[model samples]
Target: MIIDYSEQLIVQEVAPRDGLQIEPTWVETADKIALIDQLSHAGFSRIEAGSFVSPKAIPALRDGEQVFAGIRRRTGVIYVALVPNRKGAERALAAKADELNLVMSASQTHNRANMRMSCEASLAAFGDIVALARDVGGVTLNGTVATAFGCPFEGRIEEDRVMRLIDQYLDLGLDGITLADTTGMANPRQVDRMIMRALHRLTPASLTLHFHNTRGLGLANVLAAYEAGARRFDAALGGLGGCPFAPGASGNICTEDLVNLCDEMGIPTGIDLPLLIELSRTLPALLGHDVPGQVMKAGRNCDVHPVPEYVRGL
Candidate 1:
């Protein structure tokens, strides 16, 4: 497979929403706001600031409203929010979110467990949420098909099921669609074939890939998707987050790692690697645990040291 370097890919930073969702200690509202602002200055065109999910379900983000209100809105940055239903969409709209992201699991069992609703119910609710976003002039709608790869509970999800959901998302007049490997069950080959088929079926602008590093294949799968013509990807600052419903699942692909790979390959993601690394360093103190992104642990490939005087003399 060949990648087109001339094309510019879009990276949607999801650290605030997907990244911190699984942390035990609730990330303070101010910290979350600062993180978003830092990510904005790092040059992400779109940053998922917060989610409108119920505080009871995702307690880590209970301060979603406050976090949304606290961010410093940048000129070109588009702040997106994850909204599960019409009520969440309303809350997001009230908070002045620029975009609304709606998620539905490709696996029926995961869907029921994650959203507490059947797949059909989620699809039906999608239309309502899309309409709600439309009612507010500033908000755009994005639909995510979670567990597009293998699901922990449902095993391997069929390709047709994912395609059907994508078709439904398009029918809802959704502005974008993200295919999520919520369980990290996707491999490089699977990513290539599936993304290739999806590329043929959907426009480049409408498709986004969300991969997990649960099995350490996140970046490899991203390379496969990139080769398959995927230009939009979802990444977290420090490899944070996992699906609460998907047991044993880990974090999303590291933002710094993704940007590093793109940069080394001459792919113009428009993300600053050094700034992204700096932003990632704050995670250890902010979340109270070490993160798993490789680039953060070991500096970039081009990092060098000056020759010691003793060595030069020798």
Candidate 2:
């Protein structure tokens, strides 16, 4: 498929939610709010601020409400919260989330494992959540297909199945859809094929790609999706995210890396790269360990290295 190279891409920063959800160490509500505020200032139009799920399931993000309420919201930026069911939807709505990001794995095995429900049951519950969102009358909804590329237990996921899930999302009146590479199993070819198929059914603005760097193909897959006409993507700050339910999954596609790729390619992302890099650098101190992002370790291409001492003497 031919892609229009001139189009700008939208990058949704998901570090506050996805990035911190699986951390072994606790991130205080104050720190989460501070990070969200910083990201808001960095010019991300959409930020996954937090998730309204059971504390038992994801203890790392238990302070979703406080984080969302405490952050200084910037104009033109949409703060989103992940909602697993009607209850989560209520909490997100009460907290005044700009958008509710609903998720269900495309693979039956993964849905059963992560959500502890059948795919049919999950969809049924999502229908109820959508109704609640409609009644609330302010918040929008985005449906994410987890394990869209491949599943750890189920192996490769069928393209047709993913398309079907997209249909379901649209039927439920979701404002957007996100195809997630839950375990970093997507290749360029697969990404192109799936994205092309999805673009046929939805506009570029209504779709987003969420990738993981488990096997180090996250950025490659992003490029392929862009080539296939996908213009929106999700990345975590400092590459700090992985699914506790999806076995072998690693951190998300790095926000600075993706921004740098777009910046170098002359594609406008409207993000502040230096500010994002500064944020990435602070994660190690916050989490008490190094993060997976590479740009912080290897400076930008424009950053020059010092000449060797022998060459300088000569």
Candidate 3:
């Protein structure tokens, strides 16, 4: 029987950046490097290896430079880094990141609280970072709209605000733009409507979805976006991430679970589910807490049950 599946989905593994940033205890540079290397070997084409934020702000990823420098650069894999400003962009470039992900929030209040700057200031900084990445870094630039769906302090963000930020990023000549539900308040209807609007103005090639499962609608939201023509997504191993600004924000959608969904639906994500589970199992020792990913603990659907001898006789 021939079964048709959706086109291949590009999964950008974001464990090192979004995953580690919220953790209280810092992961060693060696472990971070090893994790990146392992994910690369596991067939993830793009991996967000680290963020170049201030060590004081996110002590968990203080060794961003060392982590990027130490990773074994495998061919056919793109190493990406999240940069908040020109300084972070410079550091990421020095470490030879293949892609520079510059972030700005949609909500004014949340932007100030998270990045210590207003939305306008962060957007202005994005242009500078984009120029630097092109002129000096020789890297592709990606702009992210953090808290795109809703803000913890400010509540719902208007769709115009999200599109406006994306317009500014597009003006900067960035290769792509990612819309992140930093607080995970996005519903399928909202995602479908927003992404459809984005598609009308921008090519789907230049769009990416960064969803968190904080409100438990992450996978549904992804499906909504996919139906609206979005092919790229950002996920973390063991569903690791949360908002420091949002009181009860949860982890990003789990990579293994997403891959399982893709595999079942005949969508090509190019990620090894078993290897992702193995990678997720190490999180307890690394983060000192239980993660939210179910597939890592329960195993996949293909994990067959053993038949009893009496049943076998029948």
Candidate 4:
């Protein structure tokens, strides 16, 4: 099927929250703010700056409030904060986050492990968060269905479970929902079917696709979703996140790689590729290790090569 070339896709950077959540080294709070500031200037309308959770659970992003407080807010850029329970949501709201991201896995086992609560309990908490946001009256709430694809622990989560979660999120007054491939178990065929079905219920503006590259099918699933008229996506810079709870999970899809692919496909992501690559190159030094993003290393497709000396002599 042909793509609609005129559609401009919305990509939310989840690196600050998802990417740094499990890191061994502590990312200085100033660096986190700087990273989000750079991303803000790079044309992203939404960025997941950090999360307000227990420092005991995720030490890396413990300074979530400081991060939200320090970032240079660009006009029209939404600074998102991930919140787990009512307390976390309260912290995010206090920090003046532009949006609150709520997460729960579709699988019962995964929800218990990741969220440390039963599915029903997590929903109860979500209800409180939703009411809080409604009363607060400015911040947008986005519910995320983690492991919407096959769950590594449970395997093959039923379609009904995912659909029901979407309905529940809507019923609770959440502005939108995200379908997350927590362990990257989704294939393109499955992605196409799910995207098509999800689009029937939610507008492209309200639904987002978050994929991990664990199985190397992340970009394929993105293409599949895009072809199915899904426009919003969540990606991490340098492909820098994995579930601390899920076994065999890898990083999220690299932001530069996704942007480069969109650039090639003539899809408009509105991200500055050169600036993003420059920021990505700084990541290796910041994290003290190499990252998996390829476009930053190899350069974009439009980069020109010089002729070899021997070839020039010929």
For all candidates, the clash counts are 0, 0, 0, 0
Report, for every candidate in turn, its global Cα lDDT versus the true structure. 0.89, 0.92, 0.88, 0.92
lDDT of 4 by residue, 1-314 (tens): 65586799899999999999988999999999999999999999999999999999888999998899899999999989999999999999999999999999999999988998998999999999988988997899999999999888889989888999999989888898999999989999999999988988899999999999997899999999988889999999999998765666669999999999999889998999999999999999999998888889999988889999999899
Better of 3 and 4 by TM-score: 4
Worst 10 residues of 2 by lDDT: 242-251
Q: Which has the greatest TM-score?
A: 4
Q: For model 2, state the Cα shift of residue 29 in Å.
A: 0.9
**Stronger candidate by lDDT (1 vs 3):** 1
**In model 4, what is the error at residue 216, expressed in angstroms?**
0.9
Instruction: Give RMSD (Å) of candidate 4 vs. truth.
Output: 1.0
- Model 3: per-residue lDDT, tens digit, 40-148? 9999989999999898888888898899889998898989999989999989999899999988889888888888998888877887787777788468888888889
Candidate 4 vs. true structure, TM-score: 0.98
The C-alpha RMSD in Å for every predicted model, in order, reads 1.6, 1.4, 2.2, 1.0
lDDT of the structure predicted as candidate 2: 0.92
Ranking by TM-score: 4, 2, 1, 3
Q: What is the lDDT of residue 77 in candidate 4?
A: 93
Using alpha carbons, what is the TM-score of model 1? 0.95
lDDT of 2 at 269: 91
